[model samples]
Target: MTDLLFQAFIAAGGTAGFCIIFRVPLREIPICAIIGAAGWILYNVVLLTGDDNKVFATFLAAALVGLLSEIAARIFKEPTTLFTVPGVLSLVPGFHIFKAMEAVMDNNMDSSESWVTITFKLAAAIALGLLAIGAIFNAAHAIFNKTKHVTTDMMGTLKNMTTPPGKK
Candidate 1:
């Protein structure tokens, strides 16, 4: 448990640093940090479970973080893309991508295959992450639009009551 917590802290810190380095909005930094921490925790859990479905786990983690990020964006009235980018940075599979490219450059077929597998896993993770973000943003937008319409109607009614009808 302690290890997990430490890892989470590290991931969050790293994410926050990245955001700061890139001059991301201060308001969005914490959200990105929290999401990063959660993603790392999920990654560690999946790794420890010794399950064969590692790819699935990675995908689920990414999706969850992405959804959370979208929700945060809605709450803060900022662009979800900004938050999601930093939030999901921790799960970008940088090592896998690098290894795959390296293998190809070296002409090592077996290594290349292994690296390709990693690439596929990373791709699935990214896809799942995107799906979650899209779903959450769509739902949030629908709800927000409905609420806005209701509020606008109510305000119009109040204005009508206060104003004398047919005033020039």
Candidate 2:
């Protein structure tokens, strides 16, 4: 849809602007922009597909961002945060914060409290999503390195056994 594409374009532009402000290298800006756009698109798609749970949608989008950021980091040899921080900027619940403040200004404590609660839930979802992906990646990396080291050590031992005492 045109609206979705427009929103994605806005998301990408916002991400690129943030990256520029934070001094992210120009060469990496496009990648960050694309990641941010993809996350926003996923969030919108989740919302459009029957289940309108904002929190769940946000969590899913955050997870996608984390996964993509991790992959981009590995492929581009950059820090994961470089891709993640800007990518997540668009997903932040800024509107909820604004609404909470507006409610407080109107002496509507209950409304303000609800909005605050919603904001916290959304924030927590984002954190948990990123944390889950980071943990998974770290565990996999550790296992892979361990396997590689063991294999390398076995190869060395085998070489020593066949080298006839290094031909000394």
Candidate 3:
């Protein structure tokens, strides 16, 4: 769809601009742009496929972005946040959040509640999707690196295994 492609292009450009502001390494800006575009295109396509399921569409898009972030982080040796922060900028419903706050100040309780509900649903969808993917990737990374509970305070089980029985 022309609209989808156009939106994707804009998303990519926006991501690049954010990356610049974030001081992301210049060499990786293009990759982050592509990731943002891909996520947006996927989100748009999901929305077009059925009833207006903004939550599900956002969830899928965030999942896609997380997957890309994991892959890019592994390949580029950069933190996933480096790519994810800018990549997700396109999906945030900024206008809705603004409207919700404005409605609250205007004493429009019904409108404020509606907007708040919608914004929370969308945000939860995105957060859950990213959380799911991140947990999986963390598990995989720990396994590959042989670091038991790498992110926890517990000591590495594999590190003990590697040390000799007589070693301190």
Q: Please give, for residues 1-168, the per-residue lDDT of candidate 1 as tens digits.
A: 999999999999999999998788887788789988988788789888887766777787788788777778768888877877777788777888889999999999999999989888787877776786688678877687553323226446543242356757
> Comparing 1 and 3 by lDDT, which wins?
3
Best by lDDT: 2
- TM-score, each model? 0.76, 0.85, 0.86
**Which digits, one per residue and each the tens of the lDDT, describe model 3 over residues 1-168?**
789889988999999999999999999999999999988899999988889999899999999999999999989999999989998888888988999999999999999999999999989988988999999998987788786432323564444453356646
Pairs that collide, model 3: none
How far is each candidate from the true structure, as Cα RMSD in Å?
Answer: 6.8, 6.6, 4.0
Order the candidates by lDDT, highest first — what do you get?
2, 3, 1
- Candidate 3, backbone clash total: 0
What is the overall TM-score of model 2 with all chains considered together? Answer: 0.85
| Candidate 1 residue-pair clash tally | 0
Poorest 10 consecutive residues by lDDT, candidate 3: 149-158
